[model samples]
Target: MVILLNCAHHVTQRLQKTFVNYGEAMMYSLESCPSPWLRTHSMWGRYTVSFMLIVTQLGFCSVYFMFMADNLQQIVEEARTTSNTCQPRQILVLGPILDIRFYMLSILPFLVLMVLIQNLRVLSIFSTLASVTTLGSMALIFEYIIQGIPHPGNLPLVANWKTFLLFFGAAIFAFEGVGMVLPLKNQMKNPQKFSFVLYLGMSLVISLYICLGTLGYMKFGSDTRASITLNLPNCWLYQSVKLMYSVGIFFTYVLQFHVPAEIIIPFALSHVSESWALFVDLTVRTALVCLTCVLAVLIPRLDLVISLVGSVSSSALALIIPPLLEITTFYSEDISFVTIAKDVLISILGLLGCIFGTYQALYELTQHNFYSRVNFTGGIHV
Candidate 1:
């Protein structure tokens, strides 16, 4: 598995570099060439990429809602209970009548933010904020991990097999974001320099991932919360860390939503009556956000949600689909079956991983409820 992931990572990194060279329209867009297993016989090329984009983005939106709701609810309850303040109105959502502790404080405000910022000039400022806050929060996390690592908390040196599956899902979830590469590369001012930038950038990302994963797992061990931020001591300093990270994530949420909106809005606008286009756009956007909120409420465990989404979607996005894209996009009569077989084998392993990891996640989630509305903020950290 280690070897497989390493190969996949290198392949994905290299493919992304290749995608930079593919010019404006990525070649893997949908087609209906029918076939039994491979070739232009089926819509495999198109559907794989499309499915990854939609499913992964949906997972992202759900995660955003979950993160926002849980963190906001945590602070709100802490504040309201201690001070006996905040007499907010009740809003009933899907049989749950939430009091002051609800997603409206998180989701609704952000819904407004989404509607407000359409101009790139205005949005770029928040993007900068997102970058800065993400870095700042990461630095704080490293500090916390470094301080805690020496204490050697009651963490296992290795996980049991069952638990390790969850770790697989979560690890991929943390590292997965390769889908954005082509668009970013395509928009770059210096396309030739992108290789240097991609390498330097991904190296730093891997370093941070390694440091956080190793140190965080070591430091928190069995005590780690859904997020490392949650493992921080509940003081003003650490609480501020959660909030700062939330701010970064919150800003990025809009950016994430923008892609899906662009995909969905034009389609809706084209179909609806000219007079009703604006109304349809607003309605569709609201419904999309609401759908994510519903999913978050339905499955409150942030770690499980992340893992499940990772297993179900990120596995393909990061592992399976890219290799297939390479096979179809770059292959010809000259390409050896051995090389093709190697690529096919990597994809097969990715598929197996996706299926196994997804089953493992669903099994864990179902252990709690078949479909019960468990409190979103109540899950113990992994």
Candidate 2:
């Protein structure tokens, strides 16, 4: 994060200093860099970055869809089995026992409609509500976690190498907000203080992640589900937590969907006449939303899907690209050898993580043992 922020500081400073005519996005910075070595492949890198961003954002949307479905399914199942008065079964008459995919499909139309609102101002309202609900849910989850934490000796502080790859992938996903760093800095009235903002924000995020991860693991041990909310007691208050978090994730889906739609819809409509542009835009939006829902249904397991997406795309965007971009952008300048070496090392680590993490995630996705543990019988394959 320090290195990415430093690179972003450099990139944005260059944008303000020399590349004032260009855009402030990562792609623009790559395309307009002064280095001759970088210029040759800048176009390719630019397009690749766009593709990766699209994949990362859509991957997030898919994860959000699955997250909402999973939480809602757990809540509804508990309600149907436990509560005689609260009958969600009668409303969702698909079957006495609905699979996870049914829950994904049930919420498809609402998701599609939610993504149709293009105005960020309107979406910001939902985003604020999402934030509030998410914070509330996290508080409840933390309350649950601290209650039954077992001895540290009983837990594996360091997991084995094979399972570590999954952890690495998920960690990358959690820390994969580098794309927003530049945007936030650029929009700030006092851009010089952006570094402080970055430091404080990351500190809080990392601290919270560590607290929740360790305590939740200690509490649940082997029975921990993909989401900690799913492992909560099947009661009214905890079920409300599931519902609140689901609502938060549902609203967040559109925020994630916005970036890819902005990139894809404009490029797609460039080929068509102005008369049919609106129709094409709406069709593409609906199609993109439905596509994420399909992907979520195909891989209903939240943890595995999150790891797969993070390894495949988040590693590139968050870990690999920024350092390489820094090296490429500053290659023509009087950059120190140690700085260059450090950048190369970071990029190499990111590359290796991406390769191994992706392989491990894919292997788990294809294996029967993992599915057997989850009792996954969605028929797409284990």
Candidate 3:
């Protein structure tokens, strides 16, 4: 916790200095630095970031795809008879599409739509709806969680130690919004208060995570879905919640997806003729989205991808990169033992997380074990 917070502050300061000292023009991303390696410039290091960014963004897209598909699948399955109190079976609106087929087919419309939008940032106008609908769905989930507190069925005080790394990775994935920090800070009306804003914002976010994680696990116990939203009852109101949440995520997808897509474009465009550039670029973007969807289908397990990406990328971005950047930017020579030890320790933790968490997630994926622990029914491999 100490290292994480310190890294956040240091990274913020580092970013501010980067904007001022390195000139704002050079700093294209939170991940960018003149010295990609330790006190030395290396194209290899830069490409490493690019590679991680590519994988990270693709993972995010897969998550969004899985999320939408899962919710729709839940709605369809539950429409038959998933609720208590003996309510009438609800109608399945989308007809008799196989769950996996729907997952793959549904992505096509978005893929085509994404290609049509020349200006990706234009989706920023929808950020308001994203925020509102996300919070609204969260509110509904929290209400369910709170109500479940009185009768939490066989809640465990201590989960298995092996699962700790998985949860650690997942938590990092969940907390990731640091990429937007620089932009949000830059756009603030009074940029001076950005630190306070960051701290306060992070505090609220952490509190919310604690509440959700605690209440959710307490309520659902071992039956907790990858997303708390999926645990909601199969009814008109809850189904509406899932739909609204999915829509919000749908719009937000293009927003996050645009960055890596933009980063890849310049390199891709350089190879094509001026007249064919637009067509080729669109082709590349479409292919990337398709690849992401394919990955989602293969590893339909939401837990695996979220944990793997978080363990693989989030750990490096949040814990490893910032510390190294700090060392490079601040101390050219004669760094202290304390500083060296801190970074090395944090980096090791990050590495252990990435290695183990990724292994666990991948192993689970190979076993086709997306099913909840208590309800494992030998899931079909993709």
Candidate 4:
């Protein structure tokens, strides 16, 4: 309910800004475009898109629920076999590393393709949606996960590795919005207006995440797993809510999937025969989608994927590429101490995060393999 209200408020704010900047003229243009078909179309297109996005969220929620349940059950079963205990392991410390890698692999190609394609409007929309949704959802998920966990005092362990990974991944995802900033910077009627919108949007997103995360951790505490869908309770009301949340997640992923494909198709086929290129592009896009889906199913570890995304793709695209692009494009500007300091800070942070995440992932993998080996040897002894 709060999430819904916040979303409404955010949209309203954006629309109000647009109205102030462009006046009724922008609305008129949308309504009275040159083509009759375009002009006649109702706001149905927007509503339809919203509805589809909701459904997509539900799909992702369902997948998350299934995956989380299976993961928890697997852990329980393993514990029973090994020690007859159902308590969760401190496995999350390693989980972030895998997440960083997976996300990097998934996003790198897509980000590159977007840069090459240079469709500013679409990129702006995609970036905004990715960042805002990722941040908002993180808060909601964290709130849900920690709903029932007990904490004795004010300064209780505010964050665990799992929580940290979840929030960090979200923060990284939030930077996706930065991609939209540059493109839209030139499009605004007043370039100065850009800073207002950019800062306002980011501040709102960060606030929302903090609120949601704090509430969620307070509620679910240490036992909270799967920061998104699985964190929520299983009552009918929650189930219904979960359905909506799931649909939202599905739409988010679908959008993420489509953005890269759309950008890549044109570039990948730039040199080919038009007809043949279109066919090839479609084939490649479809294959990529299938492969990602397969990997999601096989891996089914959201934490690992999130960490991988932050460490690799997010690091490269969000941290490295932006600064490089800025340096090359804006080289004429005199370099102030402030500008140099900010750039240096951002680069160092991004690099450290990536390295830390990668190390964690490799360490976890080694641990898992070693445990498996020990078990095999014990079995032989038996």
Best by TM-score: 2
**Reference-based TM-score of each model:** 0.78, 0.86, 0.80, 0.55
User: Which residue ranges in model 3 land beyond 4 Å of their true spot?
Assistant: 1-41, 80-97, 115-121, 151-153, 183-197, 333-337, 369-382
- Candidate 2, number of clashes: 0
Which segments of model 4 are wrong by more than 4 Å? 1-170, 178-196, 365-382
TM-score of 3: 0.80
C-alpha RMSD values across all candidates:
7.0, 5.2, 5.7, 14.7
Error of 1 at 321 (Å): 0.9
Full-model lDDT, candidate 2: 0.73
Error of 4 at 155 (Å): 6.7
Instruction: Arrange candidates, best lDDT first.
Output: 2, 3, 1, 4
| lDDT (Cα, tens digit) per residue for candidate 3, span 14-99 | 55653321112122223443345522434444566566666777778788888788777766656765454523223323333465
Taking the tens digit of each residue's C-alpha lDDT, what string does model 2 give over 1-382? 5665665566767666522111234454566567666566666676787788789888998988888887777777668555423211221223425777788899999988898898766777897899899889989888877874678687656667877788778888885465545544555568789789789878988888888877777776655667777667766877898899899988888877877887799999999999999999999999999899888877777788778888888998877887776675666577789988887887889899999999998998888443222422111110
Backbone clash pairs for candidate 1 read 33-41, 33-42, 34-41, 35-41, 35-42
| lDDT at 88, model 4 | 30
Worst 10 residues of 3 by lDDT: 373-382
lDDT of 4 by residue, 221-287 (tens): 4444544344444333334334444434433444444434443465679868877975677566655
lDDT per residue for candidate 1 within 1-382, as digits (tens), equals 2222223334345456443211111232112112334534344444445556667776887887777666565554454233323222122223334532266335665664474465544665787998899899788778767772645555445667777677767777864445455444445567457567777877888888777877876765555567666565545555666788888888877766665565567778999799998788888888877777777767777778888888888888777765655455445425578867977997898788788889988998888863453333212232
Q: How far is 212's C-alpha from truth in model 3 (Å)?
A: 0.9
lDDT of 3 at 322: 55
Could you tell me which 10 consecutive residues in candidate 2 have the lowest summed lDDT? 373-382
Note the residue pairs that clash in candidate 3.
none
Give per-residue lDDT, candidate 3, residue 11: 50
